[model samples]
Target: MSNGVIVRRGRYYWHLSVQALYDGKTACIDWRSLLPLNGGTTKQRQSLLASSKGLLIALVESPRDHRGERLAHSTVLNWVHDLRRLIRWMTSKDVWSFSDLRVTDIVDYMTFSTMRKDGGGEVAPHTLYMRGKLLHEMWEVRHQYPSPLLIDSTHWILKRRDDGDAVRRGGHLTSQLLFPCSVPR
Candidate 1:
């Protein structure tokens, strides 16, 4: 609405300055109380901004048949909601910087997000990989931060490892040989 959800720079909480339609008049929804996951330190705040930018880009380029019209807007808004929840969890632990975020933090969040009542919580390895890839995409586009992973393979394996499955599978489908060679004329 208001220039696509204003998350102010250098702020701790995830602020959404929304324009609401009430009684034919415009109003605002203030979510200032929602603090960021690490007190919103400089680095953390920057990371949030970077992630948001990346998500918007993905939404804009999404396939038309996938989500119907207005998919971009809807997808971006959905991402905002997901980010809000992540922020809430981070704030609870007083984490405020990218440096403060450890592999454990990511694992914990993944668990919290995908946990089933039976305690066999799991997020598909592909989904986990995509999430990290999205973040890396954001970082690359924003050009503010360096590579998220110090070593490329570490990042790849971390994203791919799920439920202790030792085999790494590729998501892409390869083309099979369909044409046969003609020898006789």
Candidate 2:
């Protein structure tokens, strides 16, 4: 089948295709419609869009899980959502390329994700944990991305503090050392 063509198996179409059958009707999700890519400059936007597409496609093609099972289509879609948020945040911080990201930026992103959208309160602990875990998964597959993150995300830690708040350590910090409580907002 062609790149954008929907692959059908009886009434259902493959979820990885650009189009799928829903309720016996065709539903299209064009490749260009995937990422918002709204906040960056033209060059940055192009680069990000290309890189993001490459990463998603790579993940779809490879079973990087420990059990070597293909990721569920919903999981890949959730990663797309997470990537959109991360890309927007990175653009705001003048980080166009994943390779340009630093450990401090990663820490800042972790902190930024904890807040409620309406400024009411922090997000649920599980929500924060899931987001962090997703990020770790992406980091593990960084090399598969066309533009990979250079920072060693494995060195950093995402753990709950004694007070039950999420804590992120810098890549340079060891498990015995804690980041100072005053992480810049």
Q: How displaced is residue 65 in candidate 1, in Å?
A: 14
Best prediction by TM-score: 2
- Pick out the ten consecutive residues of candidate 1 with the lowest summed lDDT: 175-184
What are the per-residue Cα lDDT tens digits for candidate 2 across 116-163? 668989877656665676666667778778777766553344653333
The residue pairs that clash in candidate 1, if any, are 37-90, 37-91, 37-95, 38-95, 38-96
- Specify the poorest-scoring 10-residue window by lDDT in model 2: 169-178
What does candidate 1's lDDT look like per residue over 114-159, in tens digits? Answer: 5433677655545444444443443344333432322222232243
Off by over 4 Å in 1: 1-71, 116-185
Give me the displacement of residue 123 in model 2, in angstroms: 1.7
Q: State the displacement of the C-alpha of residue 20, model 2, in Å, after optimal TM-score superposition.
A: 11
Model 1 CA lDDT for position 74: 35
Tell me the whole-model lDDT of each prediction, alpha carbons only: 0.43, 0.60
lDDT of 1: 0.43
